[model samples]
Target: MVEQTIIGIDVSRDWLDGFCLPEKQRFRFQNSPDGYARLLEILQGMPDDLKVGFEATGGQEWALWRILISMGINTVQLPPAQIKAFALSMGKRARTDQIDAELIARFMAFRPEAGRALPDEKLQRLRALTVRRAQMVDARKRLSAQISACRKQGVSAELEDMDSILKAFIETQISELEQRIEGVIAQATELSAKAELLRSILGIGPVSVAILLAEMPELGRMTATEAAAMPGLAPMAHDSGAMHGKRVISGGRRSLRHVLFQAGLAAACHNPVLKAVARRMKERGKPHKLVIVAIARRLITIANAVIKTGLPWRISSAA
Candidate 1:
């Protein structure tokens, strides 16, 4: 039998800090095409059991990840925070690329599921388009705010020429991005069906569907509680002995949590089934904001169930 080998690489824009566990070997490579080629050259005949893991360094690790995965390598892009916590747990405080790389290896050796597989290329494109759209939308809003400020200060004309064209350009870009997102999803049969199913629910529109498809590809595969916790909608307990402390929501992906808030709020008001869930929570003296979160949880839970079962949402009294 072949021994299992796990390698961890701490990714930076300029260099890759690597450590191969069990073998206890350390190496460094440039963060470039040449570097990637050199790294692959070193591992040309590795066994099928070989696994490589790295922390998600924003967009920096994307190219290498795609390359390795394309070559049928087992790779995971881990959450940096978890790696940091793992280092602290081991009482390793001095931070360096080499140390981080070792910690990532140890972390993966300790918990194989600590990292996630990257989504498919079409999902990646959807995320890229949506992220750019969000940036453009935010820029347009800022420009509009500046125009309003100028009007208040009696100098509105100063931005008249620039703001109009910039805002128009931003809107046009946003529309084009939306079209691209739709096109990408339409080209993927699984995503197209999922999007149709998601949009069939009340209070979930194209933007919400796009977000779920892009960010939560594991939507139907996980449990309801897991799905809710993915977006930080799950209430975390704060109990010690008999203290029985208050429950609060925290952690998880912030963008997913944010997009759900609006959908949750809208569902709490507009979706009759979800609105009833909110009403019950409210009648029990739950704060309106708390009720909204609960309704959002319900909304996503139903979404998960429906997606997993390949069915559509229906009014249900059970919360």
Candidate 2:
């Protein structure tokens, strides 16, 4: 039997620090095209079951990750939160690039299933658009708040004019991004079908569907419970011995969870099936937040079922 080889990398804007386990090799290289070539040469010589792991350092690691994947290297993009928790567990206090690389490698070795493989190129592009659109939307929201504050303070006309112009530009950019997202989905038959199915669900708008498709690509393939859990809608239990503590949810894709919460609020008010679910929970004296969480879980389950069956949501089927 062949043992698996794990290589963890700490990526920064200007350098790539790496540590290989079992062999305990440490290396550093410039984060550039030539550096990628050199790194590929070394990786190509490693064992067949080589697993390269790295933290998702904003977008700094993307170029190297893409290159490694293109060269047929098995790469995994890990969440920084998980790595930090692992560091805490190990009582590691000091921090350095080399130390981080070793920690990532060891974490991969400890939990081989941690992190995610790269999504396809089209999904990647869609995700990028959605993320950028979200950023711009947030900026517009903050600016609107500031504009309101300025109006209350009786700010200058010139400042108000500038705010209006900037706000218009941000809205235009958001619209363009939405168009690009739509184009990306429409260009692929599978994505189009999935989008259609997702849209058939009550209260799931275009943005929600795009986010689900982009962020949670495993929608159709996962179980209903798995689908709920992916967005952090599934309740987690805190129990010991004969005592059961309150069930709460934590950890999953945070962005998807936020979108689902918004979708849940909409569904609770407008979606017939989910509205009934929310009513029942509310009547049972469940808190407003808990009711929303329940609706969100139900929404995801319905979505998973709709996608899995390749059928549009019908009252009978969804109920």
Candidate 3:
């Protein structure tokens, strides 16, 4: 009887460390086309029905996973925390590419049904643009603060020149980021359409929409509760011996959470559907901010529904 194989690759900038289980064999390959070719050859030598898993380390999985998927090989991209937790559970506290590969192999062995992640190239590009845009926004804030400090400290000619140059650079980068995002929208009509639907919800705009389309592509694929929980919007349930703790939202895509929080504030004021919901919750003495969060979760649900069904936002009239 032939043994089923489990494989894991710890991808990095210059090289990748791969582990093959049942045999506990390891292979090192360069992070390039030739390296990928070697990987394919190695996998080809194994049984036809092999399962492979890897972690998402700074978009490292893209090149190799794309190659594997193109050649009809199955690959699962494990979340970073999930892989770490799995290692801790097995009493392996040390961290290394080799240990990560071993842990991933163990994870694959137990959870064979882990979902295959086939990321969209266009969405990836959008994600890059949005992240760059965020950096520019941060730079702008820092530069503005520095400029204010310079003025308060009696800036000299050199300080004035430096502050002006920094401010200009931040603005230029912000403008460039905006242009790149516009180009992404122009190229990806389907993505733009889904993004536009998200924008129709009063508070969401081009930037937020782009982030959602790129970071949370599974937004429409899962249920509302699932989507909320996926992004840590769904609160954790807490129970103890004669003690109860407040359920708190945690982890999963901090960038998305930030955008939703901003959008929720607007939705609470101007979005009729969300505004009404917030008003009703407020009447019941719920905290305004918490209600906004509830509205944000609902907005995510509506956005998911719109993308899933390819339908536009529709507001129903009250009787």
Which candidate should be chosen as best, given lDDT against the real structure? 2
Ranking under TM-score, best-scoring first?
Answer: 2, 1, 3
lDDT of model 1 at position 191: 94
The sequence of per-residue lDDT tens digits that candidate 3 reaches over residues 18-123 is 8888899998899999999888998888877888889877576787888888888878787777777778888999988888888888788877776447777887
Which candidate, 1 or 2, has the higher TM-score? 2
For residues 1-319, write the lDDT of model 2, one tens digit per residue: 2169889999998899999988999999999998888888889999999999999776688888898888888999998878988999999989999999999999998899988889888998998899998999999999999999999999999999999999999999999999999999999888999999999888888999999999888898999889988877788999999999999987778888999999999999998888888999899999999999888888888888888889899766655
Please provide TM-scores, in order, for all candidate models, with all chains considered together. 0.89, 0.94, 0.84
Best by TM-score: 2
- Model 2 poorest ten-residue lDDT run: 310-319
Q: Model 1: C-alpha RMSD to truth? A: 2.7
**TM-score of decoy 3:** 0.84
For candidate 1, write residues 1-319 as lDDT tens digits.
2157889998998999899878888999999999999989866666678899998765789899999999889999887767877888999999999998999999999997777898888988887887777778889889899888877887756567777888898889999999999999999999999998888788777888888888888889999999999888999999999899999998776667777888888898888878877888888999988988887787788778779989877665344
Per-candidate Cα lDDT values, in order, are 0.85, 0.90, 0.80
lDDT of 1: 0.85
Sorting all predicted structures by lDDT, with the top scorer first, yields 2, 1, 3
Itemize residue pairs with steric clashes in candidate 3.
none
Report lDDT (Cα) of residue 41, candidate 1: 81
